[model samples]
Target: MYTYTEFDEAFVRNRVAQFRGQVNRRLDGSLTEDEFKPLRLMNGLYLQLHAYMLRVAIPYGTLNSGQMRQLAYLADKWDKGYGHFTTRQNIQYNWPKLGDVPDMLDALADVGMHAIQTSGNTIRNVTADHFAGAAADEIEDPRPVAELLRQWSTDHPEFQFLPRKFKIAVTGSPTDRAVTKAHDIGLRMVRNAAGEPGFEVIVGGGLGRTPMIGKVINEFLPKADLLPYCEAIVATYNLLGRRDNKYKARIKITVHENGLDTFRELVDARFAEIRGEFSGVDQKILAGIEAQFAPPPLRQAETTSFEVRYAADPVFRSWADTNLSAHKSADHAIVTVSIKKQGQTPGDATSDQMRLLADIAATHAYDELRISHEQNVILPHVHKSDLPAIYDALASVELATANVGLVSDIIACPGMDYCALATARSIPVAQTIATRFDELKLEHEIGPLKIKISGCINACGHHHVGHIGILGLDRAGVENYQITLGGDGTETAVIGERTGPGFAYDEIVPAIERLIGAYLNIRQSDDETFIETYRRLGMEPFKDALYGESARSGRAHAA
Candidate 1:
């Protein structure tokens, strides 16, 4: 949570004022819808299926209590009494009025936030690992570099109008939680032979209609060279990326068309050309940014209460087992508050829930919160001693779902429910799956399953990388759901393979059930997770479960 500097404050306020004027012009009919579209998109306003949506940037997915409270207030006042946390670690207000958007922007500026660079063919929000500073396996916190990129790329004149929207993600840990390999640029922190931590710069990674894992263009880049090296990559893409067709306009396609060797050569040449223009000023700034992320002071405290509760309360035990993660510090634990409760929307948090989260952050968790790419809120630094009380408070707000990596912890996009780009509905599908799994009582037993659903090919829900990837398509005026198996989003990233054909809306859930049931039978043991089982056995068993006569015979025999 870096507070805004004087320059940052002034810049955001000025942008809000400019947008206020643009909104007024549109209101007064001086600008038409087509004319206002691009201007408004630059500021993160989208014309969705039902109404205007405002996406607020959460840089590196970090938030302070005040900012979170303000978000709750905005949700209560402007739109409905809720906000949707997105896959990019941003929040979207889906029912914003055209005239009310300026006021919303001004409100966000009061707490060091805005919607700039969130949309419209530019470098979007710089996302990082949700458990960045706290993760036990981290080489170093990557948020400082993410913040530096945010400053460098925001309103950078050269990249403002690239061929398509660009995304960048950074992660400090060997385990990739930020979906780094699926961004335009993925920076994974690594230790060099000299034992100094640097970055493994990955280029041309993206997911949409075309999903591809990023390539390692640089085996190791010094910490000081991150910005310039990134600049070279984007600059190279801007020149060579296809603009003829929207589908082929992403950097992934550009890199595919040009080949990695040619792309690397071009980037290196550009890095040589523009490297001197940066000097050491960016590193100096990064030093200042690093100071802002100092770990919170934790006093020595007994974990007796937490241990006692874990033993006595099955409910609390279930939550602790699933929702908590290893922190670098013994006293602290990373708590992922699951917004995806059974039968609920995956990422939608009510104003009451948001306020409760903010209060808990302020009171116990060092006033810090994080939004995960999986669309869950994070209390990144809570003392283990305080787990019981925090769990109680979260339960009061219906957030203690205890299904962090379980089947119920699904990632889904707005889809046809609100997004005009969607060909099918994703919300109800997610809800049904979550609820169905819960009713079956097989969710926890299934073990570490990631089910991601996207309304369309844009992969907003990261369906391309889910262990069970569900993509909704419009097939001859019918809603057909396609399934992809063995997709992964971690260090070894892979796009899923599609099953033969799509299922009608009603058949999708049953198909998923059969697939999972088949997995349960085929797995070596309870410890064998869905992903490991898939890799070992391949997609044949799952395909048979979904579309084969043998699966039908098995089900009929069981009946």
Candidate 2:
């Protein structure tokens, strides 16, 4: 984890002071709610259904044990005793007092964290792979680069007010866990044909009312020019992106109108001009940043004992099987603390749970934790020998839910409950689906399936990429649900296609159950996962089942 320097420390302290003054003004009527809304939102404070919601930036979803403890403290003392971990690797408190937000910000600042850039139409938090350091096939950990971008983009004067919120994701592993294809700017760390480290830069890929996969602007850009090239891309978007219509203001729209070839030409032209001027500065900053991310010293020890323990403890074995990923070092493993409890909201972690996670991280995980895009916490570098002990502690905290990569482990967005833009509820939908799957006891049997739910077309839940995607919509003042199939959020990413007509809110769970049942019956074998079966058989069967007797009769007659 990158520690905040004196400069960074002071900057955050001053920002807290600044926001405190703004809050005071708003409370005293010196500033109207209309005037204060944007300012408050910019600081991650949102006026929600019944109260204000405060979103805290987790900075590429990496946090130390101490920081995690601080987050727990904030949840316990300020808002409710629980915090919701979001899809972007951040956390949200749904019921924070407007006046207390500054105090909360101060508390976060004390722990080398803040809420800056968590909201509003500016560059949002930069996300990266949760398995960055531990993944076996990574070129290099992407967090250090993500951290560099975080530092440079914080209150970046040039990008303070962009056309709309911009999101950037980086992935070093070929697996694409970061969902880089769906971001405004996606960077895939790659090696050139000549065998040199660089980035395959993709731009204008985004999801919203309109979803488009990013196009590669540069097939290969050297590592040294990473920052400068990114700066140029964002700068181009900043200057040329639309500002008149909020709906059409994103860079994706700009790319859609301009075409990729012309956009590439413009970006190339801009990159050539700015490369020399700030390339040196980027290098200097990255050098400092790299020093911050140097690996912690590890004591080499055997982990064969863990494999033996796994054979003995069924609970530990199931947890180890579902939640653990192999690490680059044979002595260690990546342990994901599942926040997806069977019936609770997929990502809600109580204050006590957060504190326990922090303690667990400090004790057995090298004091490091990461929040995954799938709405789970990760202990990135745990020694395999410590697996049993770590598993025991996490089980005590209710963080040992063995549903990772399973059907009950859902990714969802905060819908009508908190987001003003949302029309229907997403969390409840996810909850119902999870409950239904758990009841069936068919989750593991379904194999690795991704079910993502977005409150609206914005796709905040990344519903567009789920193996079975559900989108919540408000139709004629009634809640309606839309389903999409064949989506995959991985190295072989593909946008899902909408099934038949949208189902009413009450019909959603049954519809999902029917689709899954259809899959089970038609699959070639139990060995085939839902995604694999869907891909092998296509949407005709699933669509036939989903559309009820009408489609069934149509298929029968046609046959």
Candidate 3:
């Protein structure tokens, strides 16, 4: 993790003081709600439907035991007893008082964390793969570049007031764990023919009312030109992007309105002009950042206990099979502590659970923790010898779920529950689906399925990229659930296709059940995952399953 210097500490403290003064002015009636809205947003505070929500950024999803403990403390002391981990790999407190947010910021600053640029139209948190340095197949660790971008974008004068919010993500592995395709600027670390590390820059990707997969603006941009190229892209968008309508204000909209070739030409021209301005300063910073992220020391340990437990205890075996990912080191495994336990909120972790996770990370996981974009906390480098102990500790806290990529492991947005922009409740729907699937005991059978639900078109839950995407809508004051099939957030990214008319809120779980059942029956073999089956056999079969023969005919006639 990148440690903050004395200058960084001073900068955060100054920002906190400024925000405190602004908050006092609002409380004293000097600034109305309208006048205070931008200020609060700049500080990552939002007034939700019933309470104030504070979003704290976890840059590149990396954290240490101390930072995790601070988050747990804040959850217990300042807000509700739990906090929600969001799809952006950030943590959100749904019920923070306006008066106490400054203290919250101060607490975050104490742990070398902050909520700055978490909201607003500026470049937000620079996210990377949760397994950035630990992934076995990574070309190189992406966090160094991610940190460089973070330092450059944070409080960049030219980009503070863009037409719409911009997001950037980086991934080092060939597999797209970061959902790079759905970001404003997605950088995939790739090696050129000459064996030089560079970025495959994709631009204009976004998901909201209008969803799009980013276009490859530059097939390969040298690592040294990263900052300048990124600046050029943002500058072009700043000048060309729409400001008249908030709906079309995103860079995705800009790219859609202008052809990719034209946009690429503009970006190339801009890059040419600004490329000289960087004189290798960003790369120098990146070198320093890379030194800070070197992998922790590995301890030699026996895995006989882990093997014995796996063989003797079916429960432990199930959890291990589901929760573990391959690590770069032979004796190490990446453990995902699933927050999506059955019937609970998808990403809500209690204060005690958070503290337990912190303890586990500190004691066993090299004191390193990662918040995954899938709403799970990751111990990126856990030795095989420590699996049983870690699992025991997690089980004692009721955190051992034995469901990581199964149907029960869903991604859900805080819909009508906390968000003012939501039209329907997403958490309840997610809970019901998970509980229903768990009751049927078919999660393992329905393997590697991603069911993402979003309350509205903002796509916070990334519904547009799930294998089974569910979008909640308001239909004449009633909740309507729309389903999209075959969507994926991987390297082969594709926006899901909608399956005819939507079901009511009550019918959604059953509809999902019917769809999965249909998939099981129609699939060629058990090995064929839901996404593979959807790809092998397109939307027609799923559509038939969702809307039966008569309903399909009625819909055809209506059309």
Best by TM-score: 1
Ranking by lDDT: 1, 3, 2
Model 2 regions lying over 4 Å from their true place: 550-559
lDDT of 2: 0.87
Model 2 worst lDDT run, 10 consecutive residues: 550-559
lDDT tens readout by residue for model 3, 62-90: 99999999999999999888999988899
**Which pairs clash in model 3?**
none
List, residue by residue over 1-559, the lDDT tens digit for candidate 1: 6989999999999999999999999999999999999999999999999999999999999999999999999999998999999999999999989999999999999999999989999999999999999999999999999999999999999999999999999999999998889999999999999899999989889988889999999989999889999999999999999999989999999999999999999999999999999889998999999999888887579999999999999999999999999999988899999999999999999999999999999998999999999999999999999999999999898999999999989999999999999999999999999998888788888889999999998889999999999999999999999999999999999999998799999988888888888888888999999999999989888888888987655561111
Error of 3 at 132 (Å): 0.9
- Please say which candidate is ahead in TM-score: 1 or 3: 1
Candidates 2 and 3 compared: the better one by lDDT is 3
Where is the poorest 10-residue window by lDDT in model 3?
550-559
| Superior candidate under lDDT, 1 versus 3 | 1
Candidate 1 ranges with C-alpha deviation above 4 Å: 553-559
RMSD of 1: 1.2
